[model samples]
Target: MSEISNNFLYEAIDEDIASGKVKADEIHTRFPPEPNGYLHIGHCKAMIIDFGTARKYGGKCNLRMDDTNPAKEDTEYVDAIKEDIKWLGFDWEDRFYYGSDYFEKDYELAVGLIKKGLAYVCELTPEQFRTPEYAGNTTTPAVSPWRDRPIEESLDLFERMKNGEFPEGKYTLRAKIDLASGNFCMRDPVIYRIKYVEHHRQGTKWCIFPMYDFAHPIQDALEGITHSLCSLEYVIHRPLYNWVIENVDLDYKPCPPRQIEFARLNMTHTVMSKRYLRALVENGVVDGWDDPRMPTLCGLRRRGYTAASILDFIERIGVSTSNSLVDIRLLESCIREELNMKAARRICVQKPLKVVIDNYPEDKVEYFSVSNNPNDPEAGTREVPFTRELYIDAEDFAEVPPPKFFRMKPDGEVRLMGAYIVKCVSIEKNEDGSVKEIHCTADLEAGNGNPLDGRKIKGTIHWLSAKYAEDTTLVLYSHLFTLENVADIPEGKTYEDYMDPNSALRIEGAKIEPALANAEAGERFQFVRSGYFVKDTKNPNTFNRIVSLKDGFKA
Candidate 1:
């Protein structure tokens, strides 16, 4: 059995179970995502609460698609949502469902309210009703001209609206809850609206659709959900959610789903709004919703983040009722720590500078033993090829050495990582003064150990044998947006204004160890001194840098 969570959400559930309000074995939750766009990190938290809480109690959680608004809903997003949830180690079992599955029931519940004199058909459009003449203030309640329409007339007009009788937005069915209440949602809110669009699943079977606040509760109650866990934004809407449950007649009466609010996950350096994300895709600022720089789950996965690292980050953050911004570096640290112990080590030269071991036999080749992962004793070691000609990262060498620089310098000694200690003898340069070939003589007898003369070598640099290296592509990524929090963009500035143009950099013809050539797509590796990377699933011989080896987060 899973351990019990000490968070407020679980505490409340514990209280409910203690009071017999909810049977411990009957604890049920759900993750209902609208099928419009890809799931972002924000959704991951909700998934954890819904599925994790259920797991804690050995209960069940449903994966329901809140595909209420069909304007942009598609099976494409639906499939992606399921894949993402499953990738995060969650399973809804046999309880998969769509919001449209209860459309007929939603319509029936609205009609039931009309017959009971608790609802009426409103003729005002949203624009007209939101005006001062109709919208009420703290001292006054909003007025609806059709609030008192006869129940019989309302029943007929609602039926006609559903039968495609009126054009879109010409009529609506609103609940007659309160006209002078402080809560605007209870002030004769429209429960249903007319939309002349085809539903992704329902087709054109109906024209009028129930709004989210109205449909969500009904779906929850019907599904026998005991706890409705949602983001903190819905705390104010809880009143309307309960009002719907109390007024509308339903079969699952004794135990309606209790709504609990928790803070949403807000991360630094990225925007989670679907509208802004769509604009980025439509405007060609990003490759797509799955762009590595995007915060979408698929984007993170493609960028080399494993489910374990993301869950670890979430666990460290814990659950809170108040809103806060999390530094992206915390997320980077999690992946770095996991990959350091798990990912196999490899050699990659981003900007290759040729090196020729002059004293090494030209016709001879040797192999050096290197640990696949130094932190894992069971990982064992692999043999790395060493030849007369090799390539090292250009940054590792300095024609002019910087202060305290331990790497290669003029006539300086450095170890060709996992091989022999070598000292630079001469360098060949191009016309522009760029390094072409660095000539060195290796201490063949040292063999990846201290020099026989007891000379100390501080620099150890990764290198790939020229004959055994393969050309590959490397894509480096940075923050998607320049701003730390796109949620609070400066006034008069759009999210697009903060888009970082250099978020992703692609380098071609980078050299990697030949063994890396056999790595399948999605395989992860640590490139020695560089960051962890994954072979791009869509591109052959290409790797995307996941996170740098450095951890900027202090904690």
Candidate 2:
């Protein structure tokens, strides 16, 4: 069970079951996606509702592929979609389905519609269908020349269309709805078309395919889906969805499916359209769908987002009818909250400055016990080696300290985190006027227990021994786009126009504590005073900073 309370969608399902509106054994749902592109963050919300709702009711949820359009579908996308759903911690088990598998049944249904005068073969070109003057308004429809064709002739032509007798777009099977109906979709929408192209799955089996509108409801009904949830865009198609089910004759089916629409997830600073995201990949705007900057599920997983964190985010956002943009900060906050309690702590310095303890013995080295997680005592501690020579963040030291600076400065004192307090006495400068090395004297008694006693430090900073620190690579990722609302761009300019040029920055050399030397890929850690980072699976030696520590000092 989820830690958060159930939202309205779940509440509705619970009520339906309690009132006997939905049978306990028939409350099945499905996540039907077209296998044409990778799943993005927007898809995550729908996935949660589809799978999560079913689990709550002890019902089954199917992961169905709406592969009606073969031109854009591919096995690559199918595999990626499966992998993404698994990563999100949802399983369809053996309930996987594909609309292409019902091609024959769909075609037969189209023929039946034609013979019953419910559908007809249309010869109208695409241009004539969309022309403003010829296209009718709410009260009228531009009649097709082929609407009055004889039923037997239409059925024979439809069979020939399926057998590859006609070229692509030369003929179509359209429903014979009210020509003067208020809803334009009721004005005889297209049911099937000739495409001559080979399908990825069915490959050359048939040239004609059923349209989404005509195929989806039947597919849902055949699979015993009780509720078909979709985005608000499908609300208008509800009438057509039911119309097809009512017109078609099914053999002993329990009940027809019901569809409910909700607003799609709209995220700030990100574009959800697959076409726009594809443009980013094809035009070199991003490396690929898995680029850490992208909103794709794979990208978020690679960038260190956890399944629990994503679910928590979805719950926090909740389900609503009104559309609004969710702030990216809310998503980051969920990650931070989850990591704060689980991710181990380590020390890493992006820009290193050498610090030498002058009074300490050159060959002497000791280990300090540091807590793995300060919030959880049972997590225990690990020993970190401390030597005479060490490395600290370059920004932690200043030759001439500012008014409020409390870190390492000449004649000033600061404590090395989990170690002894040290007073900086002098510094070595390079010919280029950059600080080469900082010299400090340690207060032994101030650390554990020694001769020199009772000293306090105003500031503390993290460090790594020069001999134990490992040189590693680091990658920093930022927002993909610079604009807050990518969909609201200027006319003529695309959402990609707002893509951030500096979304990813690669660092060749970074100093990390010995603890991270053996860290495996996909491991997450919070570098003390630095940020939360994750080991990159694609590049084992590389680590990506998910987000920096919140510094109240910075605006």
Runs in model 2 lying further than 4 Å from the true structure: 1-6, 11-21, 138-140, 448-455, 551-555
Per-residue lDDT over 460-521 for candidate 1, one digit per residue giving the tens place of the 0 to 100 score: 99999998899999999999899997788888998878877878999998999978989998
- Alpha-carbon lDDT, every model: 0.90, 0.85
lDDT of 1: 0.90
Relative to the unseen true structure, what is the C-alpha lDDT of residue 178 in candidate 2, on a scale of 0 to 100?
74
> Could you tell me which 10 consecutive residues in candidate 2 have the lowest summed lDDT?
1-10
Find the candidate with the highest TM-score and give its number: 1
Q: Following a full C-alpha superposition, what root-mean-square deviation does model 1 have from the true structure?
A: 1.3
- Model 1 lowest lDDT segment of ten: 1-10
Q: 1-555 in candidate 2: lDDT tens per residue?
A: 232255666666667678767776667889988998999988888998888777877888999999999988999999999999998789999999999989988988888898899999998878888875556776566678788999999998998998898888889999998777777877899999889778999999979989999999989888988888888888789899989989987742445677887778888888899988888888887878888888898888889989888888888887776678988878888888788888899889888999999999999989999999897788889999999999999999988778989998999988898898888998899999999999999987667433264445678889999988999899889888888888789899876577677778888778999889999988999988878999997986889988776623210
Q: Quote the positional error of residue 192 for candidate 1 in Å.
A: 0.4
Model 2's alpha-carbon lDDT is 0.85
Q: Best lDDT goes to which candidate?
A: 1
